[model samples]
Target chain A: MSPGSGPHTAERRGRPRDSGTDSAIIETVLRLMEEGATIGALSIERIARETGVGKATVYRRWSGKDALLVDVMKSLEETAPPLKGESVRNDLVSCLEFARRRGLAKRSSAVLRNVLGQIHSNPGLWGQYQETVIATRREAMHEVLRRGVHTGEIRPGVDLDLLSDLFTGPLLARAVLRPDGSLEEGLQEGLSEQIVDTVLAGVAPPPVAGG
Target chain B: MSPGSGPHTAERRGRPRDSGTDSAIIETVLRLMEEGATIGALSIERIARETGVGKATVYRRWSGKDALLVDVMKSLEETAPPLKGESVRNDLVSCLEFARRRGLAKRSSAVLRNVLGQIHSNPGLWGQYQETVIATRREAMHEVLRRGVHTGEIRPGVDLDLLSDLFTGPLLARAVLRPDGSLEEGLQEGLSEQIVDTVLAGVAPPPVAGG
Candidate 1:
């Protein structure tokens, strides 16, 4: 083996990768996740049972629980359809509504919340999942904020990072804390509207309300 | 018991209710919590071993794990001291700092996150804990926002509930999602300042420089 060869090349020289079985396992995991089974509750045995695969086959692919779970999360991450629009408001609304519909679905929400809690305890899974799910969302929102800046709709000096947090952080906080796993009423209607207003108006005493 | 008896009269029926036993149990739980123990992980025997109280005593007070956990959460809720002073800025600053500290504490944050996960699976515990901790914080923040409206610090038309969510939600979201279990540095220093500016200015397009 050449010292300069990368891991990808190294793997290519070995036994051929089986994309079919890999995708099948990941699909099953995500489907079970959509059905409200978390990694904590649904063990390797359960997955084997549900997928009708031997335990050795599962263990052979993913080294352990964390690896398997990260793969599952990675597979689900791609399902968020890409945004398509020029309007910043439209972009934000589309992304938030997607999160609201997919992440907040009754079964998926429970499993995802459980996954989030587990991620805290398992650092590797947390890092991979956060970079994929949490960071991806922030980046998408940042692009919208950047567009607003270009259009002169938002103030130029506003901190983009903080603005992103201020925009999406509320939805996450409300979603995770809610007992019924639902966003607040009017959330869909007014989130971007209020955010735009606040970013423009500043939070000091309002100027005479145009009276 | 008379048909017309009032709660105030009933409150005086017993010796000051001690309230000390509650404190003892809560403190014990907090100590265990800081050590990264969960209710599912906590055993009556272990708590008994630590507190030097008989298992019977613990059971006599709390019916089981959920009941004890509810009280433990109640104790943690007390850590968020109520806001004082009349200035909207002071109230917000104090409240946000309190949440930032308490929610970001290494041990407390873990336990609370665990409890939130368990709450979904256990409905009875969810109702009580939410009312005690979540509702208490909401009410406290509600009062502060109300003051902001009256004192002309915040715009009158802003939705009090959404505004409260807006201000505190980011703190909670960052705490649970971030790997570091701490408030983001920018938020710790400038969240309150930015919020104060945004609430007064609104996120609408600014009319002038630094407006």
Candidate 2:
């Protein structure tokens, strides 16, 4: 059965179906991911069995494994509520806290590690990852940085791309490279503030004398 | 034939054997790595065959694939000479330049990417990589940061660990995550200096008034 044709046929005919099955499949995918299933190993049949849903239902929702995984990642992003802070520092800390919490979460870290392991070999997944994960987070960071620049909290002409990398790279490295290292605890607590402080020290304009 | 028991028995008993075979094997490993052979796929048998040497010879010098791959990484480190500069800023720039050059080198980046892709699954390799790659480079950065604090170039009491990550993490993320991205050329030229400058701006002590 083609995507959206099985369980959603009733919805197409005028009855709106509940979205629980959709979320259940994504949750199952995340759980399977935490249990060490990689993109290359994930199949609709397996997901269907694990989620206790019919294969036709899964097919009716996601076109394939790639689309399912993409939706799963997108759902992960949605878990972190939008960053809302009055100042750049507050916004950065909030954004970083979201990242830190996600990194420290057991399932999130496992899923991330699995993706990092296979991303090089999977271009379609990587493209989706870039779009859903990297680009979305980058846009949030860009907004914070631009606000900082406008308010004169950050220096003008700063390379936002490099600056964004500077801000997020350390945390990412910790999460990806040292997945089992002791630094994970450190990152979970105060490291985000330290990163923001240090980055701001560089990007923030010099303090006005006696003002 | 056992390792070192056949081809190098006479040399083991008498005069020192030429180091040519050692370098040849490493060179071939680098070449094969560039060709996309991972450490798991790079067996002594393959190295011996490709380098026109006996398995005993390859085994004699290195106990197994793990030791050989470790040595290959170690040799790459040796290519970038130790960082020495009169000041912390200069030292940082010099160190980053070394990394940039290595990242941009034809075979080096591919070898690194291959290692990164497989390192998490292979503890032996991951241990060796931590020691030979991460630890060595980190020590250099530590020295520079320490000297920067000592000379009042950098702010005292900075978290050197996180700061070190900030320095190298961006380049690493670019190399590993965006392997074929166009940012490579940008990295090879001025990005290193830019990183150093931005980081130093964050870490540098306030300028002394009229001094």
Candidate 3:
């Protein structure tokens, strides 16, 4: 079956489906969620119809609706751009801004809540989802914060884990609590700035060497 | 037929049922959740049988499982005592201690996650839940932080709302994440100290405040 160094080897015998099949499926799921199709309401048939893929293909890759949605969410967890500036304030602003820009989409929040709901009932999925998004995000921020501490920009005694949670908690709470399923944009930024200012006041200790 | 200040009254006619009814129903729901009844598995019949109350009586008070569970959760919300202490740290320690104790219960986290799942789907109940418990707890903490700021113990610019959320977020994330469904005891004191120290460092302006 090995064709010699040609596009022919990549091509399959079936009618050529786009190589972007995975992206298409994720997009379809996101689009469906954006349009208010909840996780409980989503079905493979609907996704297949939306993406123009056959049911058999989706089943082959993902066992069911929960699996498909989980994968779609995982795909969104690509490395968020790194913190932009050297200062703690700038780093936090960048972090919050990233959350604001990427985290607050109505569709994403709904899907997140729906997925969270599923996790409560399904133990197998909980660890994977938590590890992929929640833990991964925290780990990245922890690294950035540790760097800040090492550079004498942050105080020595701060609990990096607790501080990181404190930094992001309000935004997450508001997103989770609101029934309209929209993050109040102005509120998010304002709250982010407030938290940053507060933490900076506490964490950046007295000058040590390079004054 | 209203009683005219007599020993026998219409209110007393069903007084026996009314007196023990709420407690009996709540106990049933709590037992089910403790026994690992998924939110979907809770039923009026189950409660009726457990409480030995007629199904009609259960329906009369609570429209369905959602309403019944909501009422049951409301009863538990009374567990978080109001913040009362001489200082912000004292108040927060007390408040967080409440969460720590609650988190330590074998069934507490599961019960909470189940309620959260219900909250995500049921908007009315969600609002009610937040208004009764989440909002109350945060507001009390906000008052504590606000006092701290006024007394110049906390920085003037501290975002009280966001700070409260920061204090609570990790506890919540941990509550949902842990399979054992309780917080490790050390984390309670450790996180409390971390939050107080972090916030104080920021809010206590330098001898000559930095730009």
User: DockQ, in order, for the candidates?
Assistant: 0.33, 0.36, 0.36
Candidate 1 per-residue C-alpha lDDT over A1-211 given as tens digits, one digit per residue, 9 for 90 to 100: 6552322322466865566767777777777765545566668877876777888777777766667777666656645567775776677667666766654555555545656667545767777767877788778778877887787666677777666666666666667766464464554566656655554445223355536
Best by lDDT: 2
**Each prediction's RMSD to truth:** 8.2, 5.6, 6.8
- What is residue A99's positional error in candidate 3, in angstroms? 2.0
Docking class of 1: acceptable
Report the lDDT tens digits of candidate 3 across residue range B23-127: 788788887777656565567887898899899877766667787777676667655675565777788777777766776675555556566556545657777
Model 2 agreement with the true structure over A99-195: per-residue lDDT tens digits? 7767777666655554554554456777777777777778888998999999998999988888888888788778766766544664447888889
Question: Cα miss at B187, model 3 (Å)?
Answer: 4.8
True contacts kept of each: 0.48, 0.51, 0.51
List, residue by residue over B1-211, the lDDT tens digit for candidate 2.
Answer: 4553345555665657658878998999998877655565557788888887788778768887767877788777654576666877888988887776676675766555555545545567777777777777788889889988898888888888888889987887676556665446654468888888988888887777888
Decide which is better by TM-score, 2 or 3: 3
Interface RMSD list for the candidates = 3.1, 3.4, 3.5
- Global fold similarity of model 2 (TM-score): 0.75
Instruction: Give each model's whole-structure lDDT.
Output: 0.66, 0.75, 0.67
Model 2 chain A is weakest, by summed lDDT over 10 consecutive residues, at A1-10
Better of 1 and 2 by DockQ: 2
